[model samples]
Target: MHFVTGGSFHGKAKWVQEHYSASRVAEGWFNGYEDASWETRDFTTSLVVLEGLEQLVKKVVEENVIGGRAALRGKLKLWLDWEASEPDRRLVLIGTDIGKGIVPLEKENRLWRDVTGWFYQDVVMAAERADVIWYGLPQALK
Candidate 1:
């Protein structure tokens, strides 16, 4: 899995395409996916692009799941594991760095920032190649 993240509008998708040239790319957020059924789907030899991953986490945290950090981390791990199960498929997770800059006043927003940043760190550490994009340029961090 290749994890790529940056602030919004930083051209992460462009970088992914230019580098991987993956034929099948599927973007999430409007993905209509749920944990119960996600593992059954096929992702073999494909490139799955999940844009705005923070939003997905936020949604999950709000709706069904509970137990805070550990639960959230485990849920995310399951999702990522499903993506990685098909070894030939490359999962390109495009997320925004919401933990930077001024923090938000709203409690949920603050939590989102914290959790997203935390999860990103964990994900990056596990990824074979991790990148951060700035001004449409990619910096390979791992």
Candidate 2:
């Protein structure tokens, strides 16, 4: 598992595509992976790029709310476990560094920031490799 994060439009996706050469890239929002058909596809032989995770965090935390953190984390873990099963495949995750910059004014925005930061911490901990892109340059964290 690889976690690639950075400020928005910092070429994280370009780096992933250049380095990994994926068959397909999946956008994140993580909208419906918990549904009954989540297990239908095997990620082997393909690289899955989960881009815009902070957007998902915003939706998950600020919007209608999806079950709660436990439920959301459970689904994430489920997906990670599935990805782990296939070494030949790769999962490249790209999230904007929402934790940086000035904090938001609204409570909902603040909540989104907090949740996204915390959730990204979790992902970095679990990831085998973590990279942050700045001005199209990638720096490895772990």
Candidate 3:
């Protein structure tokens, strides 16, 4: 598993595309911005790019489906298991960094930010590789 994170519109998607498009088509691209349903996705491709994970975190947190950090980790375990199921398969996760800048005034926004931060930490910990994109340049974090 690979994890990439950066501010919104910082070219994380473009970098991932260039890095993996040689072996994978656009069909493997999954945008959580459009649909945040992780359970409904079918992992049949060798390369799977899952972007907009912050949105998915927000959705799950807002829905109150996550009872605690353990619950969230369970969700991540599913994806990790999928990646480990195949030696040739690669799972690239892209999340926008939303914890920077001014803190949210609303409680809901604050909760989302906190949950997303925790989720990102979990991903980075489990990821075999991790990077942060800045101005379209990727800097390895792990």
The TM-score leader among the candidates is 3
Give the per-residue Cα lDDT of candidate 3 at 109: 93
Cα deviation at 38, candidate 3, in Å, is 3.4
TM-score of each: 0.76, 0.79, 0.92
CA shift at 48, candidate 3, in angstroms? Answer: 0.8
* lDDT of model 3, residue 104: 96
lDDT for each candidate structure:
0.67, 0.70, 0.86
For model 1, name the residue pairs that clash: none
The candidate, 1 or 3, that scores higher on TM-score is: 3
lDDT of 2 by residue, 3-105 (tens): 9899887988788777775433343222122332322345444456676777766666754555545545775787688777766656667788988889889
Error of 3 at 56 (Å): 0.7
Q: What tens digits encode model 1's per-residue C-alpha lDDT throughout 61-129?
A: 565445555765675576578766776666677677777799899887787777777778777877788
RMSD of each: 4.0, 4.5, 1.9
Q: After TM-score superposition, what is the CA distance of residue 46 in candidate 2 from its true location, in Å? A: 2.9
Model 2 regions lying over 4 Å from their true place: 23-45, 63-67
Lowest summed lDDT over 10 consecutive residues: which window, candidate 1? Answer: 28-37
Q: Is candidate 1 or candidate 3 better by lDDT?
A: 3
Candidate 3: residue pairs that collide: none
